[model samples]
Target: MFSRDSRAETRADTAKPGAIPTQPPRFSGPIGVVSSAAAPSYQPASPDRPTSILGPDISIYGEQLILKTKGSLLIQGHIEGDVHGETVTVDDGAHVKGVITARTIAIQGGVKGELKGSNVILHEHSVVEADIIQERLTVADGAHFEGSVKKAKNASEVTPDLS
Candidate 1:
């Protein structure tokens, strides 16, 4: 066994007070100490999926109905009764004669009745002859719209882009 004095001799010098001891260089590349500043702050954008504002499933009466869904309803038929939904869409080939109440209504067809919605979009192929109440409305070029529209809420400028 070595004596305390001999063991002390084996050991080198100690670090001075208040002095930080240097660490041996690591074999791996520089270790990144990730601070909050190194990382980017991020916020995901809201999805464009249209949510249902009101009404249940769609209902039709005595009219040829061809329906497509993209978080909205597409109607290609002759509607007699009242039509209601969150987002109601009518194709250019459709011919409807009824009252429609919805959150957002898009028409590329021929409609002859009263229409109510928060937002209304009429395409170039549309021919509408009805009184409309909406927050926002867009009518495309060549679209024949013969209706008085009442703005329900403050909205952006109207555009003539049917599709």
Candidate 2:
């Protein structure tokens, strides 16, 4: 059996020219070795999926119930105020009672206020009763809508200044 010193010497002899040393380098400062378990995993965000979600049991009331998101927003509950997002989706059984402004707005539930978006879609199960201002508007068959629709020239033209 080789001794510790002999083992190190053997490693040195077998190493390639100008190769890194087999032994870990000594450091005077605190070591910062990061293992896989300690390191955080990164995932790319998806544009089609909402980053924020309001569950079915959730209910937001009052005029201060304004929800604004830079990413997509999904609502499965009841909201009594304005909502603004990059993409907004009102799921089935959800209800909104105020204005909605977004780049893209999809409704599968009920809306009772103005809706302004670059692109708007009302599913067959949706019920909307408000004025709509959009670059593109689509209403599926069986969708109940009682609103005036105004189409814009482009998405940029329809984008609202929420600030």
Q: Work out the TM-score per prediction.
A: 0.51, 0.66
Backbone clashes under 3 angstroms, per model: 3, 0
Q: Over the stretch 15-87, how does candidate 1's per-residue lDDT look in tens digits?
A: 4666553643111111122222332121211245332212223335655332322344456555555566556
Backbone clash pairs for candidate 1 read 123-162, 139-160, 140-160
Q: Which candidate number would show the highest TM-score if scored against the true structure? A: 2
Q: Cα deviation of 10 in candidate 1 (Å)?
A: 82
For all the candidates, what are their Cα RMSDs to the real structure?
26.0, 19.5
Specify the highest-lDDT model's number. Answer: 2
lDDT of 2 by residue, 41-158 (tens): 2222365543566878999999577888877677889999999887777877999999999887878789999999987888767899999999878776778999799887677655
* Model 2 bad stretches (over 4 Å): 1-50, 153-157, 160-163
Model 1 ranges with Cα > 4 A deviation: 1-71, 153-163
What C-alpha lDDT, on a 0 to 100 scale, does residue 134 get in candidate 1?
80
